[model samples]
Target: MTLLKTPLLDTIREPADVRRLPQEKLAQLAAELRAETIDAVSVTGGHLGAGLGVVELTVALHHVFNTPHDRLIWDVGHQCYPHKILTGRRERIRTLRTGGGLSGFTNRAESEYDPFGAGHSSTSISAGLGMAVARDLGGGERNVVAVIGDGAMSAGMAYEAMNNAGAMDSRLIVILNDNDMSIAPPTGAMSAYLARLISGQTYRSLREIGKQIAGHLPKFVERGAQRAEEFARGFWTGGTLFEELGFYYVGPIDGHNLDHLLPVLKNVRDAKTGPILVHVVTQKGKGYGPAEQSADKYHGVVKFDVVTGAQVKAKSNAPSYTRVFAESLISEARRDPKIVAITAAMPSGTGIDLFGQAYPDRTFDVGIAEQHAVTFAGGLAAEGFKPFCALYSTFLQRAYDQVIHDVALQGLPVRFIVDRAGLVGADGATHAGAYDLAYLGCLPGMVLMSPADEAELMHMIATAVAYDDGPSAVRFPRGEGVGVERPDRAEALPIGKGRMVRGTGEGDVAILSLGTRLAAALEAAERLEAAGFAVTVADARFAKPIDRDLALKLASGHSALVTVEEGSIGGFGSQVLQFLTDEGVLDRGTVKVRSMVLPDIYIDHDTQARQIAEAGLDANAIVAKVEGLLGKAKAGRELSRAG
Candidate 1:
């Protein structure tokens, strides 16, 4: 791959450098920065389209504002690659999403420029408002700007923060990056001129002077003047909603034009308005031909050919857990017309796109609102329709209240197909599906399950659909499954029952596994057997209402018991220990018990194999654990003989 020359970008070391450059050179700098961003993401596959769209906007913001001092927050942070390059991180830009490298999103610890960390969307307004209030209380004057995508506005949190900020009249600047042409109409020279004119100090000062004079006049006349001013501007600029919320609204200006951005931003910075919103219109994948042609296809990519725009994907022997779930649901929906699918602004991520292709009328994409998605599922369930709420495990945390209050508490038969159940490779700790087991298992009457492979995933889906008594969830990991033969026809398994995968007879040690960790447990069992220690491997299919018979039998029959799961501490293993203690299985101290789960610390982004090994949930880790346990047991026997 030929490296693109960044003669202009190579000169800058910080935002101050960007600010010092001549305004004529800034357009060239933006072009260089855009090329650099593309090259970096091509090396380390990550969010491409978002960063490309905001290249000029990023350069303009840094050039106009004194960053690290002036607070600049990027909502969702996927678009921060360009921002990162300007903020002393250009050297490490190529290492994005890899271990010990720059994060895919804005991180506070990563740099001073990233004042607030973000992985989720629709949070910048709230964080920016808090920073703005803090600056006011400290009697300091630092501009607070939040750049949020139009898609993020679909979430309720953005509006909630906007309402509060509007009421408080805090000096906050919100830049709505409208890339999809959804929020507002197209931008032109007229809109750009109006934005510059309205945002200028002169216009704002005159408006404020008119407000004071109106206050002194008759109440009816003052109201009429205010209405007339709003009507005139709102008719042309379409900013009445923001004006009504107590913010001075500007733009729908061209985000790609540095000329327009620099002047308008300078005006807003100088103005003393309490809260202001700037609407900047730009295209996703603005400069790149491949990305511009199909923005969504290139939104997130693997290591791709920079020129050809062809992504390189690893060949997989088995299908992805996501695909299996989508297919299973599609098959079941065919037979059961009542079955419907729902996603929270992630139709493709949650595999709802495939289902939508099959059954468009039955599939619903509820836009970045997880809380609403859960309750909406509950409403459907109440009406005798089976709603399969498909969401990633990490995202499910956002709708816990709805899950409990509306679905679980009322015993609504909402089947939650929780995708990405374990450590996600490149996305890191923020996206890891590590807490779903702990969170969902504790709920009363919630039937929570995890699949061991692609085959089990199908059965679990079938089981979730069949079990209509209450809310049930099945979490499976990201990436391809363990190449197991999928069932010809998936059949629903009996609830709360475990099947022995290996070693039915009595053994020196027993391994009880849940979820995809079953594969590791079986491998460890083989090693244990080879080392002359009898080992039993059992797959506990359900986390909640664990198979008590299997738990008790394993505890009593083996000298040592080890539980494995790809989740946090207080999950499947915790439930098993609690059940054993209540059953008087642990009172005698005859059996040694150990629960293996993810480490307490958050594991950074790396390959999933490395992450599991680091968490001590891999086969080698399991084998070492068994050897240590059996060694202690043998020593105890020796002490007994000696005594």
Candidate 2:
């Protein structure tokens, strides 16, 4: 209950309360809201910079429009923390991103104010257009506003939605929250004044007349008129790009100013003709001193000191998996000049930033556009260069088509380094890398490997670089390594082969682990041995192109074989099952097989250990499955004796 003195914000329970106040008080409300947001996130440790950027914009939207009725769709939802506070969740603002607390992103079920849940980027325009279309079909006359970021705008989906919305002539409001990816300072008072001037009644009337004239005129005449309009808008407001896309482009206004936001938003809300884009320029970290000074550092923060605005960094004993990947890539690049790295707007997250330092020319940050990054890497691979397309497993879903058609189908030698390949805490299901195993494993000519540890990851990276036959991928989970000493030089491993961690024992139980779950598998083996049954543990290095020889051997040596992976169903386990069936191993009748994968349900934000335990892939769960199999064998022996 760390309460801040938010006198203006304390009076508000919902956005309706915000509207009830006079226009003069709205500015004060915005200031108070910003302070309250800072205080709340200082306690909760969620997204701060984005919410701070949109303080006045949030205030203006709620003030000008009748929300809930006027569907305000927030794309990507990271900026919705302030929106949540204004829309009746202020009391729970401090509980953000915690277990059983308010989500980091918006959820429809969480509140009516949140019209649509957002996690994946560049979806707001499409969803807002849909809402507008739905409204046209007897829903209501309410306005639909979609607030999207500059980083999100880099995604092609946003352009697609705008193109469609323009053609459909849907009455939708798209607010391009131009934080500029924290690259430069936001728009100043001149831009704000220009926005206000264009949103006036005279400009609206003239624009309507010009549109009518262009519609009736000949093709040549219409082209001339359209060019004139584009030139006029572009020269005045710098919006030729949006004008061509069919949206009535309106601003590059300062988003932090309530005066600029209120007038333009009110005008757009009142005047309805076609799709409108309000290009509001906002700083990522607008008000707070620490945030404004270092937007990226404060963009996503840990719990920190409020007065000094210093963040708490917990010291770790081991290096993060990201650093290991970066260092390994650098080592590989030093020897091979043909190797290159690509990231989709997550240089730091993918460890490509570190790679960029050593080999700046070889590193390409494609900027928030995953689909382009994949195909771009595919193009690079086609030219006989080793192109590593490093993306988070969840984000890679955006570029699945490119992986299949452009890379795999074409038999290009693209290397995919799928990072954060397991349930991630705090960010929850939205960013979890749970399904890459199933998705990428099924593709033809795709070589899929999962590293058992950091050292294994280095080895896998080398393997991917060495393999020039077709596309190769290595999925590794989030967080630090298991304290394994990394090799100075990584050697390539044989494709489709697995190594035995524990030698085969006399007992009828075996555990085969995939990815980083090898440690758990070994622990389970130890527990089984302690329980009077000898057990063996093996690491299946590759999910696709599985080690058929090793698999068959494991199956033959044991009466029961259990496969474990930190992935959803129909992945490594399914592949193993299919292979065993094809080989007639299941028909032997003496052996039983069980697969332990993540549950069918989407596990939410929790510690990785807890998530593994809940999915029944932990050491205890493995031991239980083994004991059950052993008991079944004992029962069968008694039945055979009776016979």
Candidate 3:
């Protein structure tokens, strides 16, 4: 007779259910939990590998600790999917990361269980510390646990929090999930040190025996046993990184084995002393074969075939803009020895992987520290090196103060290769690079340029590197170029210059395009041309310096001017409008000026083309607006002709 399948997980609507389960059945419950996590992520399509890796840890945490009351803060919270599933979000898991769906990261707005919201890395420990301190001041007896990965631990903020927590001696738990990687392979001295610390055989042996002894020790003997335990901890834990920082260090334990994890977690839960750190060793893609082997690929994936683990790749006829930037940087670096590359934990994403492979000595992966990366580049530039600080437009926000104080203040020539400058599809608003233009434009002594296509981007990169006076930025979009043929040799374009893409007669409408949005403007102009309206297109390569000559010429020549950019309203268009007003060009005539840009609201993830259309920055939208403006122009002319 077949035994009935256990309904253990289905009944686990709350932590009470988990707490009720016998210690012997936790392993089976963990199995069911893993299956549920996999199945949930398979449908929802978000942060699969991280959530899968933490299934058992999540189960053990909720089972052992009282959550919502006992705070569990997840750093860089993309790994909190399983936590969300366990905390009454199982049914709504299908909506993850969608416009109205559950958030990809832990959101305090989403649940009481999520004590703090996190998207970027290295914040959990700090947040957890705040909760712990608050709980103490209020005289609440609740545990505070922060689960951070080894990748996130490389970030300086993690250590900053650790340093602060060590001094406070507050009762807290810091779980370091060491799987030997972040988004890419982990970098820096901290990762290397942690790796060596965890791998020591003597430390492991001493840790196991200490935990066994600590579990049996009476409360009265605990204080007296501490002195003896210190010697045992030093023997087992080696350097005592956390201990020195004022934490009771535990583990480097097998995170997968329930038998091993449960006992350690239970012991740590009972400990009422200072901050404790449990170093858990778990594989990223624990059970899934393909994900287990290549964790990064599965880290954040699109919809994929479950059986083969194959993603249906988008058919792009042209190479991605990132590929172009990588190729262009490599070509430039080959010619100039002074040219160095820097990325803040994004070697592959920013296309610096190629440069790192070619010139490993010159390339630097600063590790999830954008602030450090920018300042480091500034330091390099002060030493007469042309440092290209390649970073995503969104991530660059974190280093604004550094960019201004460190680079722009000194007028250092730090070449910022700003990738994903527009609406990045699927990653949504949090990852969108829309605000860089506005922020970068406002900085004093900063020069900003955006390319219309890959070939222009290559020239812009050369221009940024060659310039020696102040910080220069070259912003480009997320996807492939418009299939334009790239030039073989790299050449520097003149700084603070704009180029005309299409010429037109007097009284014609002038379209000033910035960045990759030039393609859409060109298409709009073509449609306007067909309707017997003269249309001129100008690529405003420079945004900050404001190509005065081009703006003056276009204002004098055209009856109507429209500025188009794949950025916020206060970006290229605002600069152009300010120029027109300052030059007394707007006063000369009734020059009907219009600005086309991304809307003021946060746009959701979809195809780039769809996002453009939704924001009314698409080809058809531009054409319609221009045509309407021309109709008014013709009507005014008719009144003049009739008079």
Q: Judged by lDDT, which candidate is best?
A: 1
- Best by the TM-score measure: 1
> Could you give candidate 3's per-residue lDDT for residues 221-319 as a string of tens digits?
765676676765566544266777877676666667666666667676776667878877778878888789898888987767677888756788788
Please give the lDDT score for candidate 2: 0.88
Kindly list the per-residue Cα lDDT of model 1 for residues 1-643, writing each as its tens digit. Answer: 2178888889999999999999999999999999999998999999999999999999999999999899999999989999999999999998899989999989988999999999889999999999999999999999999999989989999989999999996799999998984466646788788889988888888998999999999999999999999999898788898778777899879999888899999998887768899989889998999999999888999999988999999998999999999999999998999999999989989899999999999999999999999999999999999999999999999999999999999999999989989899889988999999999999999999999989999999999889999999999999999999998889999999988989974779999999999988988887777666788999999998899999988998999999999999899999999999998889999999999999999998988998999899999999989888887344456568899
TM-score of each: 0.97, 0.95, 0.86
Assess candidate 1 and give its TM-score to the true structure: 0.97
Candidate 1 wrongly placed segments (more than 4 Å): 632-643
Residue 80, candidate 1: alpha-carbon lDDT: 95
Clashing pairs in 3: none
Candidate 2 lDDT over residue span 88-144, tens digit each = 998888888887788899998799999998889999999999999999997579999
Q: Is candidate 2 or 3 superior in lDDT?
A: 2
Question: Tell me, what's the RMSD of every candidate?
Answer: 2.3, 2.8, 6.3
**1 versus 3: better lDDT goes to:** 1
- Model 2 lDDT at residue 62: 95
The order of the candidates by lDDT, greatest first, is: 1, 2, 3
